[model samples]
Target: MKIELLAPTSAALPTLVVAAGERASVRFLEFFASAIRNPHTRRAYARAAGDFLAWCAGAGASSITAVQPLHVASWVELQTQTHSAPTVKQRLAAIRHLFDWLVTGQIVPHNPAASVRGPSHTTNKGKTPVLDATEARQLLDSIDVSTPIGLRDRALIALMVFSFARIGAALAMRGEDVYVQQRRLWVRLREKGGKTHAMPCHHTLEAYLHAYLEGTGIADDPRGPLFRTVARGTGQLSDTPLPQANAYAMVRRRAFVAGIGTKIGNHTFRATGITAYLKNGGTLENAAAMANHASTRTTQLYDRRRDEISLDEVERILV
Candidate 1:
């Protein structure tokens, strides 16, 4: 197979799998190319599978089919020493799923990773840093909306905060995704698993979105990306969509300018908004629905209300 076929993916075929012959190699590539729909997940699984197979080769496995549970377990044990439990667990899950796909294709006699157990992990709270309502407002207000970049940054941040949108879904939006529904602005987000979620824009988000679209003249191109890169040498929006890394840098810079001390990221706005909503009497059930989470349990990870309580108690020591 041409190496270019693997170019579209973030991972390359391991040499052991390549040595296993064309059928195994084809099946290995197909598992990532066909079975996974989400690009991030596909990239992660490919990397995990590639690493495990390479490790097996170093451990004297002749081919991909020769990998066994011991090799899988030993690799996982090594992973635990260097990575966080959640990350290790996710990597293990990636290996297990890939082996299952290989087994189904008859490339392997059995799933070697099926019985391997990952490190134990449990969490009631997520690790994402969250800004309080005051800081969120400060960050938004600090942007100089006289420029197209400022307007776009303010609107993008507000969209994530008010709508509880994941960064992926927020960045995927197009000009047409923001629309009028019942005399109010609404945003339609295409979330994970191809789920379509639409929410009426908060009054604040409505104003920001309106300013961004009209100010940048992006409203004229409804099919174009909503958040875009600034063209070189011109203070204008480019047709190229802003990448996630750029958005992250934008957030960090905006926070520093706004005097916010929290080390925030693209997901910070989502968690900040959820915690703010719950503190203001919004029910967990409603927050889950608004966030388009399949379960309230998943939504709980973003609730940082306990953070305030912990701070309050710490302040009482008065020492």
Candidate 2:
């Protein structure tokens, strides 16, 4: 019965929540279903909320309403011992937000996580590994473009490197997202927070995209996904959108074949492009705009120009 109610939300009602009553169970399910818009965030928050509630149940909390500040605080402290500060902080946020939703629904009298504090952390740089210009070029050139799959892979990588696009946004794109503007090729990305970002293609990226679209004949189905899975046993593109995990695996396989040693992921190309742009005299403000970052501070995290300086200075030690 609870599973039926939670089917749409994909979150199970915690033991404590189920014990609270049908109203609490329904409200608990609604919190995740209606309160969160992003599927990834919703999943993360649901996991956090479930883990915390299960902990409370084991700690002798009789019901959902029995959770207290001490329970929230203890769980947060335990998280810090096993998790990084940022991850702990995100879990704490999940607990706090879930309780807030429950309180608004009158399921809980107050939010137990309201007074809890998360660990503090700060960083100036992102940890996504980046490839140098030569390596980037080599990887792209190493791909054999005679096949449709090869053309798709090459175009996808070039899109991230040249447009500074997030993998989520790039994968969300439809065939119609690649369109002409002012006699130039342009790509549309639906970024986080529902922001739509459009960027004109670099000449190299333009050529790659043209080849992928025409070679695969995906251009005819403007409503279908731009990037698709290869049909099983057919060696042809399927209508299904390519999942992010598949994209990551494709990148790793491509890197291995190209003899590149860097442990890279989908995000590597975005940071690499930003660093390359900065090295080529692109301003931080302009990079922020092109990358659709709300602030230059966020953009600066991807700028790795100082890494070269640090390496050069380390050589001076002569150790």
Candidate 3:
């Protein structure tokens, strides 16, 4: 399977030469290039795999073939000390997956990381900070929509909240993705694994999207990016899609201006919307479908409705 690849050094898998040898290095590159499709996951796994092999080199493990279960276990143990359980688990998974691919390619005799267990972790809730219904409204209303950038920001945030979209999926939108169907504005999101999800816009979302498109005058450019970065010093939307880091900065800036004390980020709106839906007589099953969650258990993580109930009961302690 020939795949386009960066040099091992460029891929952050620099130690492949010293630890994996020249022949084994090609297989290592293939592991990341072909096995992982998601860019975020590919970058993360590359970093994790690179860190592990670099550690192996420092410990005087001569080659990738020389790495054993003991080395893998020791590295994982050290990770658990400095990292969260989920992070350590993901790092361990990266190593195990890389080794599994190497073993299949005959570069390694066995998967050393397969025998090393990762840190244990379990949680019913996600850690993504969520705003309540009131805070969400305040933030949305606070945007100064006289400018094109303001309109874009409001629309992007509203898209995430209303559609329960992942930030990557929301930013991946093209102009044509937002369109009219059945006399209502509907959004088409190309979600993870390239799944196309379509949903009718919430009434508020319809207004925001319409205002953004009409105000920016980019509605006619259907093939262009739906959301774009403002040109430096020009205050006009550029052809480039907004980067996720820039979006995070924009969220922080907007939240500070709106007097919202809760630390929120791009994902906050998705959880906020899910919680609000569940509070208003929505079923968990339906919430899961709306959020495009593969399972209700995943959707449960975003449900913060129980948090309000707990707070209300706590307030009943009249001292």
Candidate 4:
């Protein structure tokens, strides 16, 4: 039995009226608000908690009090087998936090997830996949820039490779983010954790962007999306902005057409950009700042130094 509560626009707040049977439950709404800071994180945690609650209902543990450590351990085991280590860890953490709130609120005698351990982090090394410069060039060359859609794809690929943008940030970009001063192109990007970073556009990227803009007839609207869907069927530019999923699909399609049998995605361009920059004598700190990583350790994962070892230099040592 569920009840819905509605609040008037002029009212300061909604009223909560719990029935006699549901009196012993924890304040789920309050707990949810306090547990989550960001909307994205809140959604993820809510989904995880929903899954656990559904499992608990099926297992005949309808209330938080009926939950036990064995149930949590079994759930963790199921998640470990089905999902990646990081995902399992996140879900487990969410469950642990939920039960902690219940215990603190005195709704439950003990926290079931307290004794449960998440998936092991045995292979915690970051093994990000990336494309080499040759493959990247091949991808760019594969696109025919004579057509509007092709020119757009070329510019998008160039931005991804040169700017090292996450697919979300790239898709979120608006036309006004690009600024031209003294014939030099620059882009202002809003990155993760709500941080903004400015980057100069490379000459190759600038040329591609100019061609794309000219071919697409994009307006100078700062509020409009930078990348839009090219209406190949109608021979016009789409008003809608490209979503993150579309960006991934575009990369995959390009990789297929280029005949580059690599698992290339948006992150591939970022990893490739960072690795290429480091190989060309760029410092880890610069890469970290560009990548919007909080720590050098995160950026170092993309810097594959082992591939840079020179066998000729080692063999030619006279000492």
| TM-score of each candidate structure, all chains considered together | 0.96, 0.95, 0.95, 0.80
lDDT of 4: 0.76
Considering summed lDDT, which 10 consecutive residues are worst modelled in model 4?
12-21
Comparison by lDDT, 1 against 2, better one: 2
- Model 4 segments more than 4 A misplaced: 1-43, 100-111, 122-127, 181-183, 305-319
Candidate 3, 1-319: lDDT as tens digits? 1223864553444554445666787888888779999988988997888788889888888888999999999999899889999999999999889888988899989999887888779999999999999999999999999999999999999999998988998999999999999999999999889898999999999999999999998898999999999999999999999999999999999999999999999999999999989888999999898888889999999999778889999999999
Q: lDDT of each structure?
A: 0.91, 0.93, 0.89, 0.76
Summarize candidate 1's per-residue lDDT along 69-178 as a digit string, tens digits. Answer: 99999999999999999989999999888889889989889998899899888899999999999999889999999999999999999999999999999999999999
User: For model 4, which pairs clash?
Assistant: none
Instruction: Write the residue-wise lDDT of candidate 2 on 226-318 in tens digits.
Output: 999999998899999999999999999999999999999999999999999999999999999999999999999999999999999999996
> In candidate 3, which residue ranges exceed 4 Å CA deviation?
1-4, 7-13, 16-20
Cα lDDT, model 1, residue 207: 97
lDDT of 1: 0.91
Judge candidate 1 at residue 219 and give its lDDT. 96
